[model samples]
Target: MDSTQELIAQGMKQSVPWVRTAGIEFTEISDGRVVATLPDVAEQRNHVGGPHAAVMFGLGETATGAVVLAAFSDVLDRAVPLVVSAEVRFTKLALGPLRAEAVLGRPAEEVLAELDAGTRPEFPVHVTISNAEGVTTGELTVRWTLRPNR
Candidate 1:
């Protein structure tokens, strides 16, 4: 809805080939929260006829990335954000359209202060995956780092 959100979403859609191929849409983006959705078409289904695991992972990762970028966009010129690690668990068969919501694990102010002190900061973003019926089907946690561009 905001300019930054729009720019980030548009830029990612164009720059990330896999994002385009998978039809991921960033619906909400703010300082510490982000939400993304994946269409539940045949192309997104897996062998079980539900949403594929990889696609769900992609949505989780992308949602987290957007929240991080929104909170740290000011420091991006000096540091490049990267995913250090990720862990995901599929709880149920993800049928129908899927939604992923992500939030920062730590306070944005604390993380930004570390960056201001010229130290690389690592933070976790936790995401919950749910189907159109509002039932949770997966959980994902991603550890992201802002490595200073030397």
Candidate 2:
């Protein structure tokens, strides 16, 4: 229930209505960190009887972007964030409930400066998705751009 977590929860509630509908739950949010969980159900499975890749990618990217957005919010006023690029790698087929976590890296100062200068800053965020056994099932790198709202 820290400031960043509060902001993330509020923003998710306001912006991503589908998250609630899909039963995606944000479990943690801290400084430059975020985690979300999604339950495994038949509806989310692919024709091959495994969790859909898009579902896994979506959860990872969204969770990672949320963390980056929260971090950038601390630097800029009226800043809007968007994902500019993303890459996902499936290390293993997800067969059960999934957990995704995003962790921030360096370049904090540069990102802040770009935000203050009204230049969109791109942050590279790493996301790891794990299955019920706590083994990593997938990884994603999402690039987010932040800019001031005109």
Candidate 3:
């Protein structure tokens, strides 16, 4: 595992207060992939007694952001990673705890190459939210961008 990935995971949990409130757990963070788990807490449950849709959205977005940070770790000091937009489709109901895994649309190397060339690279991260039963509850495509901090 990359030290940068570890740093990103730590920073997200420590620095981002809202992310901490969502109770997201980073299970994996690699070059182009990230996995997170969101517990089915009572506060996060919907009226139907299932996990709320926003919980999945938050977990999915968190996982996608982790991948973006890990992918651009080399230039993170000079760049800012932001989520421009997200398109999520809720399919089945979230009956239990949610696990979300996000994958970069393009290879990490390719995204870096674009950023290295002075282009604001926008990456589409695909997230699949699944329940303990391995049933997919939602799918999200989050568009992330890396811009010069200055």
Candidate 4:
């Protein structure tokens, strides 16, 4: 497994409520990218009987944070990344299992450099949550900040 995959596996083993509750599982990680899946179950359903917006948001946040953490592992020092800001838009009602992916793309190097400068870099990660049909159910742009622990 690569560094990104290893990191995501470690995170899965130490699953939190937000992950377990939503049945979110890390499926893939590479470079500065992360993909997580969330099953559409009764627990994740909203009053309208569709996936709750909060659950989708949680998956996006988790995926984005994982990308930033993987990209700046040196600065993170195994520390957890936090979301400083996020903008989410619900494009359609989500039903069934959903996949959320975050990709750092080619800008990873520049973002890592900024983090190394110790200026508390805010990495903007794009998260796309889609249903089985590959239709995007929601989109989120999350800004994650990494803090090194002494």
| lDDT of candidate 2 over 1-150, digit per residue (tens) | 777687787788668876666578888987678898899879989987767998898788778767876676665457777788888999987888999998875466788787778787788889999999999999999888776788
What does the lDDT read for residue 119 in candidate 4? Answer: 57
lDDT of 2 at 49: 74
Candidate 3 lDDT tens digits, 1-150: 467667888888887777888888888888788998988899889889888877778889889988887777788888888899999999997887889999999887787788888898888999999999989999999998888777
Better of 1 and 4 by TM-score: 1
Model 1, span 30-55: residue lDDT tens: 89999899999897789999988989
Superposed on all Cα atoms, the candidates' RMSDs to the truth, in angstroms, are 1.0, 1.9, 1.6, 2.4
Best by lDDT: 1
Off by over 4 Å in 1: none
Alpha carbon deviation, residue 34, candidate 4 (Å): 1.4
CA lDDT, every model vs. true structure: 0.91, 0.81, 0.86, 0.77
Between prediction 1 and prediction 4, the one with superior lDDT is: 1
Model 1 residue 135 CA deviation in Å: 0.3
Instruction: Flag clash pairs in model 4.
Output: none
Span of ten consecutive residues with least summed lDDT in model 2: 69-78
Error of 4 at 92 (Å): 0.8
The estimated TM-scores of all candidates read 0.96, 0.88, 0.92, 0.85
What is the lDDT ranking, best to worst?
A: 1, 3, 2, 4
lDDT of 2: 0.81
**After superposing candidate 4, which stretches have Cα over 4 Å from the reference?**
1-4, 12-15, 78-80, 148-150
